[model samples]
Target: MRTTPVERPTVLRRRSYTWFPVVSGAGFYVAAIALPLEHGDGFASAILLTGISYFCWLIGWNSSFRFTRTHVSVTNVLVTTTADWRDVAGVDIEGGLAGLLRDGRSLDSIAFGGSLIGEFTGYRTHRRACRLLRQGWWGAGPGRRGKGPVPVRTSVEWRRALAIATALYVPVVLVQGLGG
Candidate 1:
């Protein structure tokens, strides 16, 4: 007997939050200019602020790129994509930040649920698969509803990237915090 292949769900096309990049980039630029003027520690401060600002801008740019893609299709076999792809086994949405903290990396598997706020509105995904994809992009995994990964931001690869960024921003943030 011949068997027919199962049809995959139609892929959904969604773009990443556009406002995040714009707002973040603008904020960074302003900080870059304002920091030196207020702090004025010579070229070092200027360079530091500029570098920090550029890094923020790059984050925004990368976010935009990450979200901008043709389409994403979830199939019975596997998730298919023509654009950059990330995947998690499942997803679950529970309490607020408090719950998230308790869940740990397990929550990382699923996309965190929350109300649309500020520049994050555009990033909202109603579909489970889409949410999982976004979480994966953010370095989180997909988890079964009600169940989550071990800890948030536990992805070693993503953690490394974040660590690098944090290391670069530490001085700048400290200076800013110190009223510089």
Candidate 2:
């Protein structure tokens, strides 16, 4: 009996330096807890915590980019987009990291771009990865190139969680502020 061949997945992730966000998030959380206990009311603490939470969330969420032989994926704060390589028209690194799709919608990558914060965010590695991805690797689509089509899928649980958190945060802060 003949068996079907299996394709291997090539996963490339962000190569960010860890100290900055980790240290900053820790500092903010510590301040959030300490500031309130020391002098301010719970309202102040709530706002501080919310701000820090949002910062940490973005830092954690948008810290990677991944691609495979079949599909390409871009992750940003709260969302990850996985699309067939064929679906992507091209990549744009002009303002930052972005993927232009055949549908005209662009997918932006968080940690994969050049920015003023590059010094602290380890954007160099991401920039290199972006270059590598744009190197005609996804030229597997049919028609002009005559390659083939790739199936794709995406996950949004993190985005949903972020949305839910944002929704709950406002109410919680308001209640605490008004209660006492």
Candidate 3:
């Protein structure tokens, strides 16, 4: 009798919303260069605005790309990130915007659960996973053997990533705005 070897699924590639930062940054730089220089303090303001825009752009672009490119491998024994494999306790799959907001109270519930009024409570990785699953892009299926790749996350992940990127860039922009 012939038997077929079970194929192990691995993440061949990964991508994130990395273009946002790049495009924003490029626009900032272009504007900075193209904008007319005004006399006295206004010149400084233009320069500052340009700098802030560039800073925001870089942060958004880098973080988005970095998070998206991250990949993992699933195995019988464990799941692996780029560096190490740890025993995963569980996988929580939160739906997308519709899933989370379906009740129109999910946002409030999430805030209450986390015990913070406006704290960002999502991870980009989670959103990516959810998206892949929804599109049936994860490439995993049912097997009598065991549980397949678990899905977890929501669009909040993207929001969090954006928030973080913005936070990092905002201060610098503000400072420049003030000084300029």
Candidate 4:
């Protein structure tokens, strides 16, 4: 577990995929052994079925990764790569959150949950990080050069909408408070 300096958490996560392993194991156990369609020498068939099921599950498991507040972690069954958010220059959301760094290297965030690439969904987490970077909460370290350009899309629009909505509501509340 690498350490980071980010004090807040962004929305970067890949949770919808971890369930694939669980579902495959359970489905195979229930279908092939627990309640076989036909009862006749299922021992050999069950072993093969289990092998295939676990293979698919393992494949899904190894491909998922996540983003923490200060770091983005990409993992495989054997290796995991982590990059600090401070080094990111921009986040390209074409197919996934591709973090472009000031050093000219880019990392592809784990895109699971049918997130446009059949498995690349970290929309919320990506948005929060964009918002934080735009707010300067997760960017270049002082005295040290890091931080890149603002992501193409930032969360300020959402904040603006919220402000407009609040403005509309406050006037109504004020009117009610002064009148009979």
User: What lDDT is obtained when candidate 4 is compared to the true structure?
Assistant: 0.49
Better of 1 and 4 by TM-score: 4
Question: All candidates' TM-scores?
Answer: 0.31, 0.54, 0.33, 0.45
Candidate 3's TM-score: 0.33
Cα deviation at 71, candidate 4, in Å, is: 3.1
Scored against the true structure, residue 38 in model 1 reaches a CA lDDT of: 55
- Which sections of candidate 2 miss by over 4 Å? 1-19, 33-47, 60-63, 113-126, 135-155, 159-180
Candidate 2 global CA lDDT score? 0.61
Score each candidate by Cα lDDT: 0.38, 0.61, 0.36, 0.49
Ranking by lDDT: 2, 4, 1, 3
Which has the higher lDDT value, candidate number 1 or candidate number 3? 1
lDDT of 2 by residue, 11-91 (tens): 444544334565676676555544443345766776667577556646664455666665677766556778767778788
Candidate 3 residue runs with Cα over 4 Å from true position? 1-17, 65-83, 87-91, 95-180
- Candidate 1 local lDDT, 1-180, one digit each (tens): 999776443332222433555476567655654554354464466456556655544443322112222222221111111222232233343331111222343222111234446125543353444464455444433333344433212112344445655755665566565664
Question: Which predicted model would earn the best lDDT?
Answer: 2
C-alpha RMSD of candidate 3: 13.3
Candidate 3 residue-wise lDDT at 139: 28
In candidate 2, how many Å is residue 52 off?
0.8
